[model samples]
Target: MEQWKKNLAVLWVGQFLVMAGMTMIIPFLSLYLQTDLGLSDPHETATWAGIIFAGNFVTSFLFQPLWGKLSDRYGRKMMLLRSGFGMAIVMVLMGFAQNPWHLLLLRMVNGTISGFNPASVSLISATTPKERMGFAMGTLQSGGIAGTILGPFIGGLLADAIGFRPIFYVTGLLLFLASLLAMFVVKESFDRTKAAAKPNVSIIQGFASLSRIPQLKSLFAVTFLIQFAMIGPMPLMPLYVQELHGTAVNLAFWSGLVGSAAGLSNMVSSPLLGRLSDRIGQERILLVSLIGSALLFIPQAMAGSVWQLLVLRFLQGVFLGGLIPSVNALIRKHTPDGMESRSFSFNSSTLSLGNMIGPIVGGVISGWIGIEGVFITSAVLFVLNALWVNRTLLAHRKQRQG
Candidate 1:
């Protein structure tokens, strides 16, 4: 196989396994806290669950850019092994947690160590020719989507048959195997002489790179808005459905269906949309996606039945799925070759910040306004973002040409 192909395959497989491991834990984490830990109040359970879950990404949010810069300096391969293998060990340790606090600590540890995906992206991006970057990223992202699609179903079955603890063990083993594959199959192409001769970098200096590019600035702002919109509905969607349906019967099944709906849609449309972006430019596709996302949520807010919500969510998933890969592709275009990982790291960190704040904001709005309010708020954000992108980024490009 060509070296680039080999690198992509290894990264894809590693990403799949790591994401699979993460999925097993995330969807079931609240249940583990509620059932086994004997959490009585639903609100309290939700709070603790949110803390543990969000905390992981919070730590990762702070560290991702740092890791990215390090990958640029040291080697992307080393960062991948460290993040993949380190997270695997943390997942295993989490299985032994006796309380929510313990779980929270383990998650924080895992996040602090997390940098594998960014590392993989940097390595793969380095190996891939510029013309093939979009397809390469789309294909790699598909692996993550595949893991997400299968994870909840498998986790649900495993938790039912054995327990959440056993699921963790299984996840840990797979992650470990992924790390090994990455270690063996993946190779680094960092030009140390080039990096070393470049200007010395600090932690803040890495973040400072964001301000240097207007396109990246626009991309980051738009991404933050879109992600914020997406986060609001996620945490409260199941509860909203159950309340709307007036029963807990098949709640798990329905919730799983809803949760995976986007992944299913994403799987079908991501590559198609990404390819379109490659041809027409990511900015054009981004505008279309934003508009599509905004329009989709209108139906979701107006959904009369659980089935309607699922259908809207599926469509929303298809449109929303294209946004991330397209955004990554755009960022890749703006960033220099050696700094690919660091750029993505900043992007990932910003995304984590969005995820961290999104749920809290969503939950509060849902409580203060209504469940449908969450959808409305999300929709409004998207529409505004679409306008912003058109008026600013697109207009700037035309102006430059003129």
Candidate 2:
């Protein structure tokens, strides 16, 4: 294998392991809070569980740009080492938690310290040739998606067999292993002296880097809108499945299947889409994906059977797969070569902001309007995003051309 491919494979393994560890909790965390943490009512459980989950992402939103800038200044490998070590420490700490508060606090801490994905993206972008950027990012993201596919299954099994705490321990150990390998073996190619002498820019200065590029502004807008649209369907899927009369025994199986279905589509389609973006242009694929995705949710909104939902979700994933890689491609195309990571970090943070709101909005809409209402809301958001991309993005492209 080529050296970059080999390095990418190694990076993917670490990412998969860490993601697998994290995935185990996604399906079960709400249950854990209610049962293990002794919350008395479903409402209380929902509130606290929602808080815990959303809180973790809050820190992720705050620290992403900072980590991106750090990667730009120091070295990608160093940033990876920091993220791995910090995440391991936090995961281990989470394993020892005695109460919900403890777990929530640990999750927040982990989120703040966890810059693994951003760091990894930066490292890969820094090393990969620009022409191959989308393919590389797609392959790397697929690894994480693969991990996500396995995470719920493995986590569900581990939670059932060994207990949640042990799951944390195992995941922490995996993260630690990933950290060790990253520190010892991963080589840095970017010259820090060159990156550093450029400037000791502040956080605002870092953001200004992105705004300086006109195309980046439109790209960021598309990113935020896509994430916002996509997030609504996720938190409510399991609940929607439950309402369809899915039993506990099969609940994990189907819910996971639904979750994994999109991921599976993403895994299969991401690379292909990324490669296609390289040929046809990132903007075209992104537009197609956004418009297709918005339409997909309409069927989901009207899905009467769990099986129907699964098929729609899987197809949705096929289009959704194009989104990140294409956006990343756009960034790579527009950004100064060495500053790809910093630009992507700003993008990562923007998506994190969308993630932080997606669930809360989904949950509130489900509670007040109806579960199906969430889909309508999602569809509306997605459709709006599609329009925004067409008007703002294509307009910007035409203006630049003239």
Q: Clash number for model 2? A: 1
TM-score of 2: 0.91
Model 2 stretches astray by more than 4 angstroms: 30-43, 243-252, 367-369, 392-402
TM values, all candidates: 0.93, 0.91
lDDT of 2 by residue, 1-402 (tens): 665776687789888977786666876888778667777788888788778877778998998888888888888888888889888888888878778899899989888887788778777776777778778878888888889788878888888898877778888888898789777767657787888788677889767866977778878877887787778668788888887745757885687678678889998998898877777767778889988888888888788888898899999999989888788777777888667778888888888888877777888888998888888887787777767767766677678789
Tens-digit lDDT track for model 1 on 257-321? Answer: 88788888887787788767767777787888999999998888787888888898898888887
Candidate 1 has a TM-score of 0.93
Candidate 2 scores a C-alpha RMSD against the true structure in Å of: 2.5
In model 1, the runs with Cα more than 4 Å from the true position are: 34-46, 399-402
